[model samples]
Target: MPRAILHLLPLLMLACALPAQARTMSAKIARVTTPVATLEGVEVRLDWPADAATGELRLRAARVDAPDLGYRFRALEWRCPLARDGQGGWRCDGELHADGGKPFRLSIALATGSTDAALSQGKASLALHRSAATPDDTILDLTRVPFAWAQALSAQAWSDGRLTAGTLDGRLAVRTPEQRPLRVDGTLVLADGGLETPDGSIAAAQLGGRFHIDYRKPAGSTLLSLDGELRGGQFLYGTTYVVLPGRPLPFALDAIGRDGQGWMLPSIQWRDGAALQAQGSVAFAPDASLQDVDIDLRSHDLSALGARYLSGWLGIAGLPDLEASGALDARVRLAGGGLSSVDARLHDVAIDAPGKGLAFTGLDGDLRLSGGAPVDSELRWRSGALQGITFGAATLPWRSADGTLRARAPVSVSMLGGQVRFDDLVVQPPAGGNGLRIGFGLALQGLQLGELSQTLGGPAFRGTLDGSIPAARYADDRLDFDGGLSMQVFDGSVDVTALSMERPFGVAPTLSADFALHGLDLMAITEVFDFGSISGRLDGRIDGLRLVDWSPETFDAELHTEPRRGVRQRISQRAVQNISSVGDASFVGSLQARLIGLFDDFGYARIGISCRLSNQVCVMGGLRNPDGNRAGGGFTIVEGAGIPRLDVVGFNRNVDWPTLVERLAAVGSGDVKPVFE
Candidate 1:
């Protein structure tokens, strides 16, 4: 044989020795347990020489599951040809898939004699391609697999999980086409239960919730939309309670967020039974601080809100015994660490609670919080009334300073055709090493005493109260009012030296006043108490008159009395008889006694008395007509009815205050009822 023929024979032998088959090895494996290989018959015809080339080879699989390799690939198939490039390098081309076992997902092309592929699962996936010439390292690409199940996913605890007919029919999709970022879209049901993140365990029970969440990959940040109805469910997120359906509830929400804009809930609505409906929108900045909010709420009964939303805040599981109903609409905005303003309207407010002794009817009002700008805001109220009493319009203004709030407007309330105004309401809370200072003034004008008395648990008093208290200081919750008042009807001028009130505007304001009454008609004053009158000019001065709890404490007083000229003092026969019996004065002058009796009260009377304040004693100048009778001697004293001398000396130390109040009140009403004590 020739030498060339020998070489050709070797090549033919080599070609015949190779397997001869031709067909596409398109295969797929998913969730496979053990390793398996499949090879179809292939056609191969080759004439091998010193530097011969290998034809192209392609590997295709919908998804290859290689547990041993910790890899599960979807649409992973490749094409590689055993050929030398002009630069003597190798490459390949094919396609790759994530985890789904579908068709050719990615396209790949290669010019290499060898190819290696693997798909992994559990937490991560890696793809590698290596060559003999470039054997120093392998081309490695890694990807993280995100949990896409809509059941339960939380960083804290195992979420409540459920796959009911409602949830199962609901489609949920979570995709992370890029590393370290994920996007979610789906719909859930109220019957789908809730996801609970307790201390450690993430579990799920009968879920009654609807939620959508989009988060970054590897799970750090998120924007969520949650809404649903729950009848009776418990979700414990570090003592956080979410309202559930079952008893009657409906809720919905829409939320969105951007990387720098932060997480925000743009819309929210809730309804509980037939009780309340609340709708609001909230926005937040990147730091999770409040940006703006608008809330509108309507309730059939505010007292019934306990079973719905307010129970948690009141620290009571049940509602108060007060029955109230109203509808409210409000809009609030905040930015740069301060509240911008709010606009609200209330309609059909009615309160009726008998046991609580509260009654009100037909109340409606419009309230504006802050205006549009962030500088100064005014709150105005219109068409407002409290408990059937109509009131004039009012406004309150607050200005912002260095991220804090300071009131800049006076507060006013009008009722019964009168107005009460408050001014200088400044609250400068301590900020940056500066102590906060507060100052304000109050004025009451033309307030009808009859209506006020009725509201204040009195029968009625026909009069008016007009006064002004200007400027006060508050530090550490202690308030000092420094002002005075003057009135004509009280027939005197009262000087308010100094008074301090703790928690004023909440409880009653404590009062300390000094009063001096000049020569005023005592008979006219007696008409106020309905006591039988004695015509005379009376004068007195009360010093250190302090009241606490609306009850007088230090009552130091002095009194002077004298008969008025030309007025026959009608000392009653009863007064003549009572005075004759109580005081040890004998009727030495029957003629003068008759004169006093004829006057129906008293005549030529001069009495000096000192009340030892806390001891409740009137140390009187012996009961007799002064100048006409001598003290400690036989004196002519009128009898029967002056003011009743109850021998109440030292009564303060022994008086049962509550019983005294009852008796005194009865006496003012002209009832001679015995004291309850």
Candidate 2:
């Protein structure tokens, strides 16, 4: 109902008191102004007939503007029969239409001390009451009203949010005191509420809640405080996705807004029984980016944490299916959208990544890190495993400050019948223009390779592994070791240099290194690999070796028996046959084929084989000629030294890497047959 009609009711009442007769009255005003709205081109008409107890009223307004509320309406018209009530009050009911929009029933009741008005469309309605004694206040009663009706008010605060769907049923009180800020207080019941921001970074759906809200705007600033119980909902903020439970969860927030500087949330609280409890303060920039935040969180039941609260972050961290169980309390602080500090206490926690061969159990710690002043902390875990290698209990002491975290002392963990020591460790977390980086020194002492081989499903190798990496660093998802690792196995030493890995925790982890084997007893190596027995001192080098997903992708390798004063160079008949089969080679000998089988073993002056692998292909080579070059026509795999000697030669120079691997595997399994030529 237009206020113009209400103001003219008194004149109508006075006219009704006259003698019964056919009469008409009209009034035209160029403009009318009120505290809340301005009307232009207002017209009012009244018609009375002697036979009628009521008068016909018509009111029209060319335009109505309420700039403060962001509401503007054009071409508003209403017609109704005006009548007097028994108590000297007035009532009118009519269809109100505005700007070619839907027509709703507009009913207004005016009494000596109070006024009531209602606008209804379909099943939705908004009713208002104002008492003359309290002119500054208005009470609104909503019934199944579309949430969109509040868009004008919402725009005053959240200019970027669009209410897409939902309905409200609640009561609200609006107060506008003279020379004071406007205030609104309400208790609202929301159902299926949905809202979204333009950038798709913040959105909510199926949000259902009952909330009490206090909102005020004073000149240039806005303030809002709300406390509510959310029944269920799903919301996304940047990479954080939150899914409210079906059971009610208590939530509260208080915030202040500046005209062009966005919002400053002074308080936020949430409680989910036995699962999570959190309190935080956050500030956002004009562009809605997080500027500062401080939060404290506790979880008594971590089993539910991953799916309910951690999925979005874990997915982005490349551990989407990570699992955990235990109790934890943590506080985190951020400044300028980067981490400032973190303090966490864990109790009997267990974390696991299925199918990744990484897990930890019985973790207990109070870990603290700071970006400003120094902070010290310690973490201890009972057991952990990486790539199937289990390690025993260990404690790590740390100090953090100035955006860097460093180990306070060397830490050692029992692993594979020995210990792995880490020293001089320093870590820098991801910050401006940089990713996470870690530097450490690693030393392996008296580790048993036999146990390692068993866990890795490799050959039953027997040795004590000892190695030192004086310097190692990890950054940009890659780990590089400046020094080398050495293992004492097969009565010899194997040194690995230029060791590095990429995507260590991500898809298809890759590793590259160079290996040098010296003075390894062939008999021990053959027995371990289940290759045919041989007696010699073997030396080899594998350079540019690369593996992807733990499978060799490329390498340049050469293995040979080097003569020594006290070492006898002999190849068993089975060894010769297996070598020939694996190399796709043939035996050339003076002895007949039938007679060659008679000898159990043969002497070899020199034996060598080489393969340069690339692009899934292996380019094969063998012992060099006397001129220090590859032999032409064919390559000698084994050069004979004694009478009735056997020489092995390979004709093919290229082989599919996978096929060669299969051949080697067949020899190890005793599934290969020799062809003598």
Candidate 3:
């Protein structure tokens, strides 16, 4: 609109040359051209009665196009009464309409040496001024103007962005000279501004800022520089979401680019006092993907850092509720769209993830990583916890290079009345289409089992726990421990083998292992479980055990008395009754059922039970009869060996696993009662 009005200045000057005797004049031009714009089908008319003091003027154009500015208009018309000012100038005021859009007021004042024009609609207005003293310079003043008015200008640089809402108020100086590039420099205030790309990957809203912008177009290339303070707003780019504080943040950027060639940022800076400070440079590909980046960041108040700058990334990484505190400084560099190097310094940092059972405190370190050169660093943490198990301080010496991180020294932490040590730990971060990979050697020494049980809320069995994992590797969300872990408890050794876990930190974690118990003291085991007293040595094996989400799924297990020389094998009446109730067995003895109530205990030659569990059912088995034959299609659970001895047999072979578990739980809670019959 302003361009159309400016082009009429020359025509208006020619009107001043008309003879005073001339009553009317008209002219038509097929096309008129200017450096920035072109007009077609232009017509001008003026009428003045010889006695009148002013002339009536009309201007019309079929189309106006400014390709460089992305502006096009059709059917533009304006009519106004032109009068000479007392100071040797001309003034015209009239209504202007274009492209069947709303009509607006266009006022032009032409002086002998200067020209000024204004286009106003309702509460918004834009005014332009140019002087003969500086023919190449034009000054524009804007008041409550919609940002959409500059959509064409914005498209010249950011073709994928659409300005959805905003308002601008400020002054700008535009320079257009025949021998120089076009330039626009200005200070502007923006309010309630919004812009977004078609894919919604880049978006901002409610943005308010005061900025100084300088933009230049040199032939086929463009350059821009901006310095400003953003008051408050939210914006998202790719996976990064930033929520600005209420206090202003000072920032600056300089960029250069050409059409379809993407952009290169030479410098960028941001300062938010102690909360954050950042300086960086970036490059984007033609498709708007990141090509390279180098940034340095520092934060003195890490308590506010997560919410302000880390929430979006953390949420995407599956730790939405993570919290952190303390100070940090870091530098990162990327080349060819991949990480090339990183350096981080931490001071007294603490991180916690509630409900996930992982936390760390008092962390201090400097870690440096490079894909080319080796870097040495050390990290120390005062305390940490995993799955409710807390561990004391530890320090790790690290060397990172060639995309692998290796521990230079063994790491040891005291926990559960003992110490755990890791040797030869190596880590490879996710890259090249693979997940994280870690390999380490683990050793446990003199850990108290009773304390561990108490901490884990399990049965109170007393002894020492020790194990050595010669090799343990984690990859693809699964962890495998080679070699076995052994526990000394109940005067026996329990060994676990083939231990592996899948999705250890993900949904529905699973564990599978096999266990073997040798020569365990039944008396102590029964006392720990609060089951009826049993006196003998026991042996057991649980093979192919599987658990999902910490719940038992399937297993093949067997427990039996081991006949050690000089060992008394006796089963109390209560123990016998509890076993009968759990296994759905019946007693068979020489004495009558009534007489069985009188005995306080019974002697057993042997006792054994086996269960192969699958699909929520337990297939029960017991010791074979004397002749290695079935006794009335039943299995003997116990064989008598003394006077008034008793035997127990199980008739039911297939028992619901849950029901069996309920019966065992009842026995443990002392809710099951002995039945005489």
Top TM-score model:
2
lDDT of 1: 0.46
CA lDDT of every candidate: 0.46, 0.84, 0.86
Q: Write the per-residue lDDT of candidate 1 for residues 325-373, one digit (tens) a residue.
A: 7655556555544555555566666655443234555556554444343
Clashing residue pairs in candidate 2, if any?
none
lDDT of 2 by residue, 156-206 (tens): 678888888889999988787888887889999999998899999989999
* Better model by lDDT: candidate 2 vs candidate 3: 3
Local lDDT at 388 for model 3: 79
lDDT of 3: 0.86
How does residue 284 of candidate 3 score in lDDT? 88
The TM-score ranking, best first, is: 2, 3, 1
Q: What RMSD value applies to candidate 2?
A: 4.9
lDDT of 2 at 309: 85
lDDT of 3 by residue, 22-141 (tens): 689888888887656788898888888898888888888898887666678899888889888878888888999889888988888989889999988888898989899998888999
Total backbone collisions for each predicted model: 65, 0, 0
